[model samples]
Target: MSEHRQLPAAPPLPDPPPRPKKRQPTQDEITKARLKFLKEMSKHYITNEENIVAKEMFRLHKYNWPQILVVTAGCEGESDFVTFSSDEVLRVDREFNYQCVLARDRVGRIISIPLDFDIKCRVVSHDKASEKQFIANIIESHSLPVTVKFAVPDNHIFDLGESAHRADSFGCMALLKVYDETYLISNPLIDGVLDPHIIIIPLYLEMLISTVVGAEAMSVKEWEEYTEEVKKDAAKLDFSSVKGRKAMAIYPDIPDEAQDTDIYSYIRPDSYVILREKETGRIPKERINYCEIYKCDKDENVYEEITPSVPPRAPQKKPCSSKSAGPPIPKRDKSSTSTKLPPARSDVSDLTVAELGEKLKLLKLDKYVKKFEKEGIDGSILVEMDQLILKKEFHFKEFEAIKLTKFVQSGHIPS
Candidate 1:
């Protein structure tokens, strides 16, 4: 019998379908209210480098992977990595598996690549050194030509066991180090730790990883230029000054690490609170009142008293409500076929119990709106009220009041 002959054939691989073009909203498609609200909130950390990471990542990646849902901060232990939305591994071939990549910058190189299945990705740094050095080491190990260095002052002083820095102390800035290679070099530790809560850019780095890194490594010159451009872009940022004065201040009580919940929440939009020894520099999620903020400047501090509930604009005496200002609709004869219209209640304060009930029937507050309504009891009188509790100290009596204030400011409501 002839010996069996086998032909060596290449293994087959699954080709993922072509990705759809990302849907961009037209000017008409955008909800103006939502866009405006987002713009207001983004003013807090828009220029933060870490915060910009998420936007950069999405711009570089997510458009091609529609099924991938990006959650900014993971909710639980299970929330680590770019796991499949369905929580199942997608097999591309025998050696390659679908995975989430975390891309970010350390010193200078755009650290973009998929983490291996065997390796558990994490962030770590010594009490005396910046995390940037550790990240830079990882990049250098990848055969990428990025130089890394850490500066150690004569003595690096950190408040013992706390995240607050000693106010007005150059000792805090001593930990800042410089890292450079043929491709990228500079410092990212400017006064505060580049942690997750203060900056959501790591999420962006995750997105960029799938875009910039591949089988063909980037050239050192290209990498250097890219980092230089990023540095130039950052240099243009002017967050260290408030009205031309330097932002740093020293309060005798503000330790190198402070845990004032109110101050944490307030400064969060501008920078993150890095409580020493805490896993992440995030404020405790519990609802903390504004009074807890111990030491803060007026510009950087957030307090409760600033937000107040608005009252109904001194009951606008409308022409329709004023008896002498308008012609009233003719009253219908009792036996006539025409429908009789109920009279509007212009004076709620002077209304009788029966009349108040009749007027309240016309003012229908929806179930959601009723959540804010308070029924005040002053014996034999029903005082129906609606309020918006803005801060611990501020409460608005009605939505109408809020609207009226804006209207007046914008000239929509006559003074």
Candidate 2:
């Protein structure tokens, strides 16, 4: 009643304004996410002058702390940078969190660096743009000096410059060859955008690297020596058993009768020959037969006969099957490396089952080993068959093509 008068009915408590209908956002499509990121980064660097503000923005964007990892691209002769092994780089996510620093180059190779260690770098343009006005703005904002200027001569048409003119193109970077990719980081109209891959190198690091390279320049003499050394190594034959000054000699294995007929048997003094002699100019008169195959050269003190299995002019046998039990292997006569001793099948009588299997492996008849066991051909009978083949005096070639085939099929040597 106190002057209330219904308070004008409280102005009828104005009806609450109709709630605005929530908007269904129209989505923004990103055709090239890489391009978008590159644009944003370029713009950000061009606009932001303060490092603190820029770095804070970087943090807001959830970017990792900057780092550097020097990687070797190709072997020494192929690449311009100092040729180092690629193994120097640690594997990504291999006990360390890291990612590629830049986009792939024209070659589509991207390099990654670890966040655990901080390495300095220099950011220099690949001499892409030369327009003074265009570069002045970039230098003012980003503080990166244009190391190279992309040239378009007056006679050349600008049409061909389109690819190189892209916002993110393969421009030469000072420290690393980075692939040029622009990722879509943010769109005002889109949600759930990816973070941009940003690679920025510091100035000091580039200078440091340049200095180091300048100091390590290769001299002409050093280069020549390296070339000669490589050529020498390329010309020499490589053998495992014959190392250093030691050599392997393959004599003609000529029968005394063939000595006159075979061209290889024509002896020349004062020249190298497989047969040992007192001196290089000397030759055995009539193939002197003795306990030692090497000629007695006590004065010259050349190769001393170490193994009894060797002939004076025998070719050294290479260690077979990548394994050897004792001293040098006993030499066998054959035209090829695949030859194995054809002990009389009866000789297997003395060998155990293990020894028999090993011998079969050396002969490259391993496929028949299990077959022997499957057919219940014990060591004794196996040895007997082997002796029969040996008694026939069939060398490796005859054994492989004829005797071994029958042995594998029938599980016994034919009488």
Candidate 3:
């Protein structure tokens, strides 16, 4: 017989309702959220400061404790201000390690979280004998201290037009030479002067834009064209637009000439440009802000409502061990014995960034290596140093490859 009649078709399933789309936040809402976050951060910072002061009072007796002061000086004729106060400023001495941490990381929540900008200063009892002992102990222990002093310039000074142009693109800029002086050039330069003493953290794009606009005026169209030409000149480079969201998309195109050169030619790639402000002579002092920062031990004791603070002293040494010390290991000489330690690794001081990068790539360590190798470092030293400095100084999350590629294209390395 014929197959049984097909079962009644299953009832049609209800069409799934379309998912509701989430509404995007309005600009005002976004701004309000950011402001709220900043306020919360301010509260946290205040709490941290209070806790630090309390601990300092407990650790150092009121009579012998260190005092910290933070000051900011405005341009000439403007009043100086205390931006922030802290007694435990040196408690975060470990934060100094953050400098190395930041070099390798993308902008993180730490930077996004606003903080009160304050310069930290400490008063120390400058005893030559005590200070000498302290420094010697730190050096012997290979520890970086929080209480070193350097002579800063009597006052911060800058050429108005030049400083303004330097800051025009970045809202603020600083020039710190090998000597201790640091010149700060700040926002909205009028007649080439910083109008205020407040340390304003410029917006991110503001910095980039400042860098771009401060340079010679070139149309966006011109930039695109120039980029195209640069790509053509760097034959080894392939053109590609940076992926994902960014304020600006960097188009990497290598020209033909650049391609023929070895990839290790550039150690420090130049990512931004600077242009001199056209000026016949220096602007008058009236147009610029000149200020000076005093040299202060960041870990000295000073008068405070809380207990006094003591200078960081050397660790007291323990008495000599009662048990006999182990016998010293004799040094080996290859001339007299067949067994010899492996030859010392090559010094990395002379290796260019590109060359080190190539070795890193060969070793499949590119993921950990950065593109900005010291121009004089040696590749062997990198492997020998166990890539400590490289890992600490140059690791980039998303842009590691980009930085390496850019370095190759820049051709700034020695032959």
Candidate 4:
């Protein structure tokens, strides 16, 4: 019995044959998995009304060629109905369904179609027919009991150019507002369609508008911040003024004669601030070289080495009067002015939120104390605050922004 022993424990059972290594998935398999997940998610989010509409539309036009009437507006505010075949609409819907899945996944919530997509239809009423009539016709023709309304909430229309520029990079999609919920639909036609539009129906005159079109593909908090920013921008009188405006320069050196002309200042990659005329499209060479040029930094420290071609002129001294002036005043040398920036204070950048609030109070900007504290802005963020951020993000007035900017740039926080 003792001789039977262990027999070397049966050679460890050959390690269970390595379990076949669980085969790594290929890229194609991974893509298919992702698409399957997106498809399931999109199906889960699609409303019953949308499904009914799709089914009825397809059924009604099964024998006859289907045509979708899309209400569109041109740049001149002129409106018309653009017709699309059933095949085209279905193709666009397929693409839009894919986009909705991606947007929902990225945003972690159901959102309207992103503004990156072309406009499909509008919720506004046309001269020929109102949204109510349109929905009434569809309901009567299909004999379906679906209700909708056109009184869209939050009458805020986003700036098309800005919204498109800020919207996340994604494929094209359309918009549809059924009853109170707005969804992304698909349409491929670019012409005759407004850049950003929504479709709605009128039953109770109450509707939910899609506010996610212009969103920057951020978190919920970020989206709220962005919407507030858009509202503030829309409310401001200078919103249109800032559009299409940019800092640009045609020449390295700007002449004195061009000083009176409207000019824009730009920060160079090397930290030098260069001045250029506002209209830099085409300018005469004579206007550009009319005077000596110089550059400056963010601290307004002027550097004269920008134009080496121009010779330095000697400063002219006025002749002294014969009569003795009561104690001759000392002349200040402009060349001797300090080019160094103010020293940074460690305490200013290390201040807590409470201390930052106190500093704001000292600066007579206590009104923003609540906002700062709510946003958890401490000394580190305070040090980085600028006029644009204060105005755009915090909704500060022009004077308030200027004052805050000065306070931050001074680097001297009061105790």
Candidate 5:
């Protein structure tokens, strides 16, 4: 038995070479991939006579072929496919899942091209800290470098150093200005927790374009031009409809005679306005019986009121019933006739500090009345203060501040 000199243990295998880091695809490579995908897709779906038209469109829009690809990537053709007539050169459909642009040749043979793209988002932030945290969370959660834009509501004090001119209600419209996308992210916070997600962009523009242009099919150039025009129109302030029409104030305490006027119209008592005339100057002195109505604008300043053309009417009195003569009527003093009437239900701007405390008692918020008095927050100041001011300066809790702010903003305190 050759004492086999134990063969020296085979040299330990060297550790496998560290795998090379996968190189990220560049923009050019990504675009190429997308184009290749779209070309293969066209070849698979398009056939016979329609295939010729598809190839021509691809050739004609070679510089912007990506646009065509996005517009017709995931489409399935069927007789039941919903079609919308465009004035330009293409017909479109409303179904987001099956969204497509249809092109027709002289004989009216139809080719459907699907439009699909990654949905990007624009977030509205009230402050820089919140915006930073929001973006950080989105990046961490998705593990992708998602492109995000930030918008601050008109008059919002964003610490991010960017001035935003867009209103919160039009945030979606601002997002639409970016034409290269499909879906939108909305309601970032769910149940008081930040949870951002995507929502389909409504085919509202397509429908509007179809209605306005009334075309059977639109050329690519025409489609782009019309889409841009529609987007611009959607973003503007439209006051033409209500310009000369009579408008009603949202507040109930406004005198019935003064409530409806041809000056300003609001959608809600607290925040929204439907139509407003540009301020010219102070209300004319000739309008004797005028009440100043304050409105918050995008600039954070209040709008001056326009005097109602109608004169304020004297309060009507109820006639006493002869059947119910309860007590012997006492002679009334004549001098009291000149006394001023009590303030309207919504008018508390004339109340004293102590009177304001009494008003708070009605809302079960009297605990903070002392704080208000201590801060010299009188009726005039109190009416102008918002929740942020109350919470920051008066040290009120979130709910407490919100309740009080709403009470003041509504301009109506409970009896």
Candidate 6:
């Protein structure tokens, strides 16, 4: 008869390393964390004023970097004030590549962790480039044809509202279009008054706030209902949140239908609605005092109290490659008689983030490709990218698929 005696209980596992207490983030810490985010965005694109912000960010992130070298407009009123409204502040510099919005990912990985992606301008590369020298060179050497990518169908970039500002959502909003100079008029009437008939005024929603006719008084219950309706309508997106505008851009409407193609499918109605200070227009700086960041890597998840200092700086690039001639650019295959090479593989599961980005760029699948980059050095992101590219929503560049497959097999990725 088999005795059903349980073996002695295994020795209790060793206690885990003590977790450091969570603390507030300092102003300096916030700036550095933001700078790291900006640097990541720079890899995909370069926009105006981005250099200046980068310089300022670099200064704050490092103690040794002298403040004298990095300068800004000295006076508050005279200068741009470096508000959320800075112009040409940064550009992504890639074709069909643009910034996507922030939202909680399926892995419980929200952009807010480790740093409030809200204020830091959390941008990442979204698409592949076309007609570039490097891409051309790769195709030429491999006897592969350079294939055109699927262009993101241009939806009319939505207009920005007068109330729209970075502070409204802690700079987490998706970018809308520029409205300053474009909307400005040269009437030369800044200090002068003119005939009301000649004003050419159009009906505007903001005008209602000043209108007596629309301001009819209502009962208390009616007021509550009215306020609720306003809140509801405010959420029904006036635009497709893009790379640069300020709308807290976190709560992007990624409906089930869009679930297949949209990269920001993680955001939903119930996601924690923080940083969205609807009452005050901007998140108070004091909130940084309570900020705590949880950074996870393959080895461990590090939670740090930020007010005193920030988490360790992002991993430095491999030092050995610092001065190496760097990876060789594959030579063009001039021997091939065919003008077109081959297409990227339909199966992208085996590719790394860098490699998958190349495939997306070849096919022009930037946003979906970039959604992974936003996840930061995660292998899981690679899997997510693979599933996305296979869907019908992505327009694959079949012409370049096989060529890309061979090129990737040849082992060369731009450093």
Q: Which stretches of candidate 4 lie over 4 Å from their true place?
A: 1-344, 411-415
What is the TM-score of each predicted model, taking all chains together?
Answer: 0.17, 0.16, 0.17, 0.19, 0.18, 0.15
**Candidate 2 ranges with C-alpha deviation above 4 Å:** 1-227, 232-262, 265-359, 362-378, 385-388, 391-415
- Candidate 1 lDDT by residue in tens digits, 209-293: 1222111223557434533543454455542321110011122223437723223111211111211111222222331111012
The residue-level lDDT of candidate 5 at 350 comes to: 69
lDDT of each: 0.25, 0.27, 0.24, 0.31, 0.32, 0.27
For residues 124-224, write the lDDT of model 6, one tens digit per residue: 22434333222223323333212222121121111111111122212221222111100000011111111111111111101111101111244457534
Off by over 4 Å in 1: 1-224, 236-385, 388-401, 404-415
Q: What is candidate 2's lDDT per residue for 1-415, written digit by digit as tens?
A: 5674443334457789999999764444343663464344322111112222212332333343111122222122111111223212211100111121211223322212111112222234443343433222333445322242223222111100000011122234322211121111110111112222212211111111100010022355743453354334333422212111011112223344753311221221111112222112122233211101221111111212233332222222221101111233344234433323344445455556676676666655555567555555555655345422432433232224334534433444333
Off by over 4 Å in 5: 1-346, 412-415
What does the lDDT read for residue 140 in candidate 6? 32
Q: How do the residues 192-268 of candidate 3 rate in per-residue lDDT, one tens digit apiece?
A: 11123222211111111101111133345753453353334333332121111111111123444763222211111
Best model per TM-score: 4
Between prediction 1 and prediction 2, the one with superior lDDT is 2
For residues 1-415, what per-residue lDDT tens digits would candidate 5 score against the true structure?
6676666778889999999999999999996875564334323221122222232433333343112111222221110011222222231111112322222212222212122212222443342222422333444454332333434322221110011112222222111111111211111112111222212222212222111222224455754564464344333533222111111112223334763321111211211122211122112222101012222212212222222331222221211100111232233354432212223235667678988888788865766888878877777777666654665667664335544655665654545
TM-score leaderboard ranking: 4, 5, 3, 1, 2, 6
Q: Which candidate is the best by lDDT?
A: 5
- Candidate 4 per-residue lDDT, tens place, 1-415, comes to 3676555555444555556677899999996875564334322221112223332333333444212222221110001111122212121121011111111112122122212222222222233323433332433343222222222222111111101011112212112222211222322322212122222111111111110122223445753453354344333322121111011112233344763211211111111111212122111122111111121112221111112222222221211101111222233255553212233356777889999899888865666899999999998877666655676689764435544554565754334
Model 5 error, position 66 (Å): 73
lDDT of 5 at 187: 17
